[model samples]
Target: MPATAPRRRLTAALAVTAALTMGVTACGGTTKDSAGKEGGATATGSADPKAPLKKGLTVAYLPKQVNNPYFTTADNGGKKAVEQLGSTYKEVGTSSGTDTSGQVSYVNTLTQQQADAIAVSAQDPGALCTALKQSMKNGVSVVTYDSDTNKDCRHVFVSQASAEDLGRTQIRLLAEQIGGKGEIAILSAAQTATNQNTWIEFMKDELKKPAYKDIKLVTTAYGDDDAQKSFQQTQGLLQEHPKLKGIVSPTTVGIKAAAQYLSGSRYKGKVKLTGLGTPNDMRAYVKNGTVEAFELWDPAQLGALAGHTAVALESGRITGAEGQKFKAGDMGTFTVGKDGVVLLGKPTVFDKSNIDEYDF
Candidate 1:
């Protein structure tokens, strides 16, 4: 059930950087995010779709850096949905995924250990929004999966898709592998990652359409997600664009350190690489051809829908508004669109014919 692509509606340009923040890209440094709003999280309750999931209640994952196999398969899929809804799952963070003051002191030590939901992944986006809106004004339940924060810092954000469908599907999968034209470039991750600057503003509004009018784009190399600065910013973007034909790297540690610097240089298979990686870290650079496709999602079903949307927002069943619907047990019924976000869909692209049928 993790192969998606059709569903789009949440519009009106919902800001607070409308959701996105995959994993495996850490190391830090960058700020300047708060454009006003600070602390005071509101949203009291009343959605009761049979409100039954409220067991031992503790849920605290907080990622952006940890033992790191993609946030350890998304905090072990939020410790398998907070131990299958009986709750009480814990994991804390900060090894420098832009250590926003160690993710604001691990959200004040998981709100002084009263932990009733944290699930963060932000590393700036208003510098952890006043300690996650004061850990939702002390009652906890914040939920901001994979790299988000700034819809006034969390209450619901599980998104892994539709930042204009992952920036026009990473520029239509690198303009269908550099055919529709040439000269691409993006590298990215940590220009104060508002989900890679909202998917590089829809990959620069999908290269202004017209079927990407002969591509172009040419520069943008940030690699602060560091793997020796994304292998020396993929060798300073092919030595300052030596006619560079491709690259997108929307960060899975910048497309496996720019596919280990184009599978050991001489631009293996002559440039052309796509963004967002991890099918076991781009399976030997897509079996030695140095990547021809890429995309992501199913970081263990995006940490099991951010552990069933933080146990369905502490089981009043759903309160994060915008068409609230619930049930995520077997990974199904999830609605709540618009700025409360919740969109785990449309991502799978891999390559080498299904990238060996996926594993990460």
Candidate 2:
């Protein structure tokens, strides 16, 4: 990928403009603490931001699960970032995608291992808050990516795209697919997922717009990010709403599973489907005419951004404060925004004509 990719360039330009408008000073200095650990230095105070106890920090990435292609590609990006920074990297999680408690257990263990920082894609927002808060209290820098926990529980959140953008984009795509006047349903990952819930809210809000006034959202189903469960839920959606014109699944797992169910069913071409999906996962579906198009940000880029953010937090280059800037390897400098959130960029729409250009 080009260093000045369109998304990165746009984000960088916007970040610079926001920083100047906010009058936020760049605080990128480090100082040694009593324990000889390097920590971030505040611009106007003696207070030192916490940092790793050792150099070449260890960053543990805990996604919703292991072996899921979405997370696998994401973690691989993190691994590359860690390698470039000469940091120790480890990826750990449960095989069950929606196992919130299982993820908590992993957080506890990683905390016990004295990992320098933890980068996570939360399965459930509130379920992981207590564990993440405790991890932060244990001197571990917590960075949530993909799906966020409570804002107070983590240092920074690496968001793939703004919720409004993702939600509105999905709805617009579905509306176009269904001729802008039909009943559509949503197939989401987990009911408690923060990102999914937020995007769903925005989707509902987008439907209220005049352009989508003719479209009606029929129902929503939770797939728990499990292929079998998602497949069953897709079947249920079709069976319960035979006249449903389209379905939007904002999760990679759910979308792929929904596509599988649609491809093998009688409604293959009758009911339209569109949402956030990877090129590779939806390629066959697009080729078979089971799906027309979908949209998603690069998960690998999101992971790499998260990895760089974790390293910055652990190494004391930035304190996760608004306007703080840090270099994200080849992605360039990113500024922390309000609520300690860092936007990765915009989502990309993928279809048969250009799907082959992307591998992840």
Candidate 3:
């Protein structure tokens, strides 16, 4: 199942319950979720947990782009969290084809909309810093996800996984596939991506171990997370280094593109592809034997954690400091960390046998 399926069903349930009860319910009942899991409700359970019951407060979630599968799944988590809190939630951002200018315009529009809080995944952290700062000036709570605008502009960041953890994990996976020998190339995102660069540096550091002494990093290419560009880069790397044994693509788009190219060429089984990707995006590649494994966290759980954390902080139940713990609804509990950022959990590796079990 797609990651969005469960949340979509939850949304439908909320609507149906509202209609049947006219937004007023006895609050005690048993409900079945999209996964067919049963949930018990108390008599006082809010019909819409995130209904903006405060009367004048509004929250907006802005992904890097509106139609991207990853962000769409994340928005569902945010909406579910909103429902749990009885607050109103709106998803605002550019469409799938939008660029940086369009994202900036969306930020400005949200500001004009006078949203009480804005959660965004900035396309260009530096470029959007100014707009995020302005939103702060307008008394909007600014939180960033996937990509952060900057520490100074945003109050909190929802990171999927730690940079070092992801980088080290990718390096380990690549080394294991190639027997720790031969040349490998890195197909990363844009040069300015804060997360990607950090991961690349960690990969280099991890490759220096004694077990990886024979492994050599030949070159790194930037695909900016564009599928076509990643494909072209993968082809170029093959020509540039005929001895290449493996390729690591830290970006989801780059990883899938590399897998697609490798699957159709002589590189299948001769070279390995490992990085971050969704189960749906990499299912065929893994089954066709082009990719051995990849790593990622649950986007829904990450978004749910962010939503709950935001609500907790806004409600004065938790602070963006050490020793603070709050419930993330179905995501469990998390603690606040330094720099006002919260990491979801460790990266998980998915291979052919287990890929089907993961939805995000």
- Candidate with top TM-score is 2
Residue 56's lDDT in candidate 2: 87
Clashes of 2: 0
Supply the TM-score for candidate 1.
0.35
Each prediction's Cα lDDT score? 0.76, 0.80, 0.71
lDDT of 1 by residue, 91-130 (tens): 7776667777877877877676556777888867788888
State residue 220's C-alpha deviation in candidate 2, in Å: 0.3
Clashing pairs in 2: none
Candidate 3's displacement at residue 323, Å, is 3.1
Cα lDDT tens digits for candidate 3, 1-360: 132234223223223211211111222332211111011111111122233323234567777666556666677777777667777677766654226776677677676666666778877768877877776656566667777766777767778888789889999999999987999999987777767877899999998889999999999998876778889999999998999999999888889899989999999999988988878789899998999888887776666766776566455444354445666765666765766678888877889867876655
Model 1 CA deviation exceeding 4 Å by range: 1-5, 16-51, 55-97, 100-102, 113-115, 122-222, 225-235, 240-270, 277-293, 298-304, 312-347, 350-360
TM-score of each prediction: 0.35, 0.86, 0.81
Alpha-carbon deviation at 92 in model 2, angstroms: 1.1
Clashes of each: 1, 0, 17
